[model samples]
Target: MSVATLSLFRFASLRSRLWVIGQMALARRSAAWAGSARFVKLCGSGSGVGFTPQPNWSVWAIFAVWPDEARAREHIDRHPVFARWRSHAIEDWTIFLSPVSARGSWGGVNPLIDPSAERASRTAGPIAALTRATVRPQFALAFWRRVPDISKVIGSDPKVLFKIGIGEVPLLHQVTFSVWPDAESMAAFARQMGPHARAMQAVRDEGWFSEELYARFRVLGTAGAWGDKDPLADALAGAAAAGRRDAA
Candidate 1:
């Protein structure tokens, strides 16, 4: 089974922050990650709901796809670049994911393997949805104009456990990741006749993105913390409680 790991690094000092910035380019050519995985990307984040135009230099992410959990864990244990990043980061977190469903292409191919494709009816667990896009230059302004409303909607959504805007490029390439209690809640948010729906419609009508990908994952597990706590703790606890009640 293929596994995906999204590792977030938070640098506090100015020097450490500058080093991570340099790694954005150097890490690409490093032997550690070079040809070492099914896919790899170094990403920067945005401010506010992570949708704004301004960049958040202090936080960066390493997203990679591996053959299995063993290989993924091995790399995380011994990869020098990863170790260095963690050494500098005041805080960091990594989440392991197994694709439940994925469609479209990213950088010309969808790197995730949907292990549950044949039997993926488990919409009861924690669900993470990732959407990535390469915006066309002509439609950049128009696309961004619609983001604030979408961001606001998700930001205030009580059911949204966690959400962030991360991307490869400032304006040209954008990615959004969000976690929902279940698939139904996620679908409700996406399909509701509101800003998200309207913007999605505009994308189809305007062809705003040259390339796009959408993938959903079943949360395997996590290491470390975000904001000093696992963002999924409450959600997972609720799911566990619900399961126990059903068994009782």
Candidate 2:
């Protein structure tokens, strides 16, 4: 199956941050150089969990999709664009993920192939979810008005291993990514009756977005750390230990 990778870069100084920010447009050519690349995106992060309007100049990310893990790993290591950003970053982390379930569209179509929901449910590991949208110009205010509450809701969830607000365009195009210990915990939050649920209802009733995509992933592995830790380490380790015991 196809795989996706999200590589995050953290910079210390204002100069480095600005330089990475400029890569949003500048790095496209280099990213396109990959012969087998399926999808490529350069993203800037938000303050806090990424819902706020203020940009977090210190952190930036690159998201890509490849045919498989080996090719994805190869490109990220050799790609000049990624190399340039890493050279300036004080810290960098990359996590590889496999899609379990996906719906709707991303940039007109979902680039990654998703397995059945049943297959996703059977997999025992850390779960990651991605929600992306392009807000209709007319509903931009109403759309943004509900973000802080959603951010607060996710931020307070003890079950969330990692969460961040990242996007392509500053206001109109946005994406939220989060990691959970399992599918059950992740689904609980999505079904929780609060700002997050309310926003989903509003989207269905009022149609605030012109385009959207939602997907779930299984954490395959990690190459580096975020906030000085591999956020999914303990949970993933526990899952692996259980699997080993069951096999024996």
- Candidate 2 whole-model C-alpha lDDT, 0 to 1: 0.81
lDDT tens digits by residue: candidate 1, 1-248 = 88888888889999999999898898876576764567888999877453556688888998898888888887876788788889999988887877887888888988985554443746677888888888888888887777545666777888888888788889888887888889898888877637657667678677888998888887777788888899988777788888899899
Residues forming the 10-long window of minimal summed lDDT in candidate 1: 113-122
List the candidates' TM-scores in order: 0.89, 0.92
Query: Clash number for every model?
Result: 0, 0
Model 2, range 158-211, lDDT digits (tens) per residue? 999999988887777788888898888987887784665666667757888889
Tell me the spans in candidate 2 whose CA falls farther than 4 Å from its real position. 114-118, 146-148
Root-mean-square deviation of every model: 2.4, 2.2
lDDT score, candidate 1: 0.80
**Residue clash pairs of candidate 2:** none
